[model samples]
Target: MTYPVDLIIVGGGPAGIEAALAASHKGFRFILVEAGEIGASIRRWGHVRMFSPWEHNTSPLGRKTLAVHGHPVPDLAAVPTGAEYLEHYLHPIAQSPELAPSIRTGTRVIAVGRAGIGKSDLIGDPRRADHPFQVTLARAGSSDPVSVVEAPILIDASGVYDQPSPFTEVAVAQECEASVDHYIPDVASQRGRYAGKHTVIVGGGFSAATALRDLLPIAAEVAGTRISWILRNADRKPLTAVRDDVLPERARLVEEINRIATSADVPGLTILRGTRIRSLVQLPIEGGSTDGSGFELSLAGDHAGTLTADHVLALTGYRPDTALLAECQVHLCYASDGLMKLSAALLGAMGDDSAADCMAVPAAGIETLRSPEPNLFVIGNKSYGRFSHYLLRSGIEQVETVFDALPAPVRTAK
Candidate 1:
């Protein structure tokens, strides 16, 4: 029930994999914890592909691991889909000898805190109490919950994919009087849910952009389908999209979204932008609605007049399970854009262009994904520091950074 190692990694997504690879090279022992399957986010956003191509998905450390193990590396240019990840990334790495022995799949880290930082324990002792580590469960889905793994340095690669916060649980939604059902993985596959229905979307970020882009195609094909885009500001600007370069991905994404908002029509598309949601009052559930689902939505807008909708898709944005982060005392940045901020300085430490690409998380300061509690690091889009690239590169940066922070590997007596 208590497996111990030098490094305790939480959340086995791209970040955890990269971190595991880095630790392997340094010969540091580690146990990675994940709540669900390796790539949970991909499962949720199955339809969409990354804006960045393949190059952004592999870590410098990962490519090396591939070569060292005689596995052919994936092309940097091929775009990955939800299905592609399992084949190209996850399957190969899991099969590789690089860090497979160290990884404990299906382990979910519940909570982490200070374990130890004493001198005796620092002398290569794994079992010493107060070892400054992390603890995890064998599998949350199992009948009996048991503590399974432990480690000294707990590097958190747990991205915000598993338990997305609901729309009703925030101050903004309450203030704006908006209602949302965030992170609906079943939205697309569960057709007849929003088809031939009037929908209202709220938010000004990528999630909103995603809704706008995807829904347009659906609306054109489906008759009697109408969806509205909403944001706090009438400008209806989407965060610009840019290539994987350093200069202005932020502005570029925002600007591109703006252009999309201008019309939102790309052949067989009937969509408009510049909409906002003021409030929602659900109608009584009735039998005639799609799949016997009923709930007409009343919406107030920023630019346009009030309208009624069959459904409301509030893509406002997402927040970290801050409730969980606060438990571990993982300090979060108070960003002006209403999102968590990571430290940007971490990117500066990357040596070359390749390293820079790995460290280049979208939002600044996510690279500062460290805790005051030594030997703890964060992985995933959270550590991206600025914008959430959600690429394997960010995860790669996480591993490289954490490895850089660890002590030189302990040699076992032959």
Candidate 2:
């Protein structure tokens, strides 16, 4: 049976763009759909520098494609901020003549399923591969008048950055929900909001560290600028400093953030270890009220009490948006929400002390990229799901593996 397209690639990030490149090289009929402009998510956090340098972040296929189009490559050894990555690599690849016409920006994938079948229709049935995938698409942020496209295969590279985990395991208060900032804020650009104000930052990942790092200078320069860091771990050391780390930037970050937590030297800075925010509410700022314009947070765990802050930064990590593939037969890990097999492989890698360095984790085998739903694969950070250890390099490798496993296109577009 002839399908309208050989594959449907969801997302326009690095992984998605790589998949599109691979498909183009293989002469497959494909379309890459993105909810926003290509690299929209990266553009959102464009200010933050990535730990991995350009050499490790880009794929060989992407590099070749760009070189063929006469695009100048970036210095492979230099660490680039998110903006640099987008400006030098992702944007050029997406705009390359090879991929430009095949991409559809401002389009969001609503759902995916096997054509003419429900989620339960095929159970471990090899014949399931015979049916093309039915993909529902709508304009981003709209639900009216959806359109359907069919493909023999589907690749979901939609990442997790947009779905940030809540500050607390439990449901957050309405006030907290309305007030907190989930993404890393550009402290340099938003100095007016943070200067001389008490800001509370939560989470223990690189994002949290990045926020603290950016805010420390602000705290030192602005009098009355109070900053409180909340960590659920009693260890106080929120970041792990990989011994003799290869990435100099990552090593420096771990050392600096850990030093702040351990020494408590920065004035107006407070680190509350083993503490959790039980509830948060915005305090009314009335004229003459010295209580300040901010939030009152009830705490629990090691530091159980109440704290006040003028701004709250919920730097908690993100989880994959799994709802888009609700109709597909995909098994996700109970813990990471990643593909079951890949999650298990990653979890197994964690047992080794070397795995402490994300670069040390073994590349997941191609089989782990497979799902019960044939011809459907989730690649990139989305494949890692809630797992925080994903590197751009891993996503690049995933694209290679998925394409390697696919058979040659039944018919190439003329």
Candidate 3:
């Protein structure tokens, strides 16, 4: 007899954990498989602080569940760093008695599909609905499969942190692999490397702003320090809007960046707006020193000029890793944010379809989260696909909406 579980959650982040908690409360058997510890992705940016206060970050279900278990909730008004959010809230919820048994950390989900059915199976096939999902999972350290899980419902809350957007605007033949740095490195620790170097920071997102902030102190201390800020938009600075803002931290973030840019005391700062990196050519250093050469970037568009820098910080943002979903055969909107119907609703609900703008769209309930693959659902940042703006609260709300739509006596034994 196969092990039976009502739902199989493919992640253990805020969305996955919250979904697991809701499933338990609804009296359903579920299992949550995570490739790492709870809040694994959040831990990557432990140095960064979140915009939302504790209240907004914590879901009603998560907070209530934690509170009932004697977990001390942080002040609702307090904004937490990614580390604190993981350590204080996410960890507690994952370790809770209700969820701990169901969550399997250090396990990677390789593929997901319905048992005895291929992606080409016709919708008219009644067996598709009744068929249990076959989820293949592997141990983190090895490629070999440990076990296969069968469940009627599958909630894919896996996030999108691994795939950072490419640096070039168009395809280039140059081999400049060593010239790229996608993530924000702890500049303080490696101050010596960036001290006297000419660094070119790319992208117009919050990550680029944070990278700039990280390098400012180094610039002040080190002599001959030069930095170039490049972006596609020339009209406006990188900012989270202040007007009609629900989160003060977000507004403050924009304010901080603006203040840094305008400050007269901050020298060696150059802003190159409306620029596109057409190609990148690595220039070898005349004298081989510890500093590893530099990159010469070809530019185009409004700001057309070549720039050379010792380091290229490409904070172009991230995209969802939908490679695992290809086998499931779900229809994704190539132009919009989500699956066909979902993409339409998201675009329609929000007048503008920008990733950040779509975050403001009200939740369309659980029905919208479902995919064409019957019981399979996609939530969290992965659901947003190429879109950038995804909030912890929004994902938590999605979990609630999903559980709320659950049918009674859930999955029948096949």
TM-score of each: 0.74, 0.95, 0.89
Among all windows of 10 consecutive residues in model 3, the one with the lowest summed lDDT is: 350-359
Is 2 or 3 the stronger prediction by lDDT?
A: 2
Candidate number that wins on TM-score, 2 or 3: 2
lDDT of 1 at 165: 32
lDDT of each: 0.56, 0.88, 0.79
- In the range 197-225, model 1's lDDT, one tens digit per residue, is 76676666666666666666667778877
Query: Number of clashing residue pairs in every model?
Result: 30, 0, 0
Root-mean-square deviation (CA) per prediction: 6.6, 2.5, 3.2
What tens digits encode model 3's per-residue C-alpha lDDT throughout 1-414? Answer: 234788899988888888888888888888999998888888878878888899888987788877898988899999998889998899988898999999899999988878787888866354576778898999987778889999888889888876776778666443565447888777867888798999999887778888898898777778888899887877455554544667776767778888876665577788777788887777765564323468889889877878888999888877767777777757677863456666666767764523344446798776577776777889888887766667787888788887777784444565
Clashing pairs in 2: none
Question: Which candidate has the top score in lDDT?
Answer: 2
Which scores better on lDDT, 1 or 2?
2
Over 7-69, each residue of candidate 2 has an lDDT whose tens digit, in order, gives 999999989998999999988989999999999899989999999999999988888977988
Q: Give the runs in model 1 whose Cα sits over 4 Å from its true position.
A: 1-3, 67-71, 115-130, 134-138, 141-145, 163-192, 236-260, 264-282, 286-307, 325-329, 335-367, 384-391, 412-414
Q: Lowest summed lDDT over 10 consecutive residues: which window, candidate 1?
A: 336-345
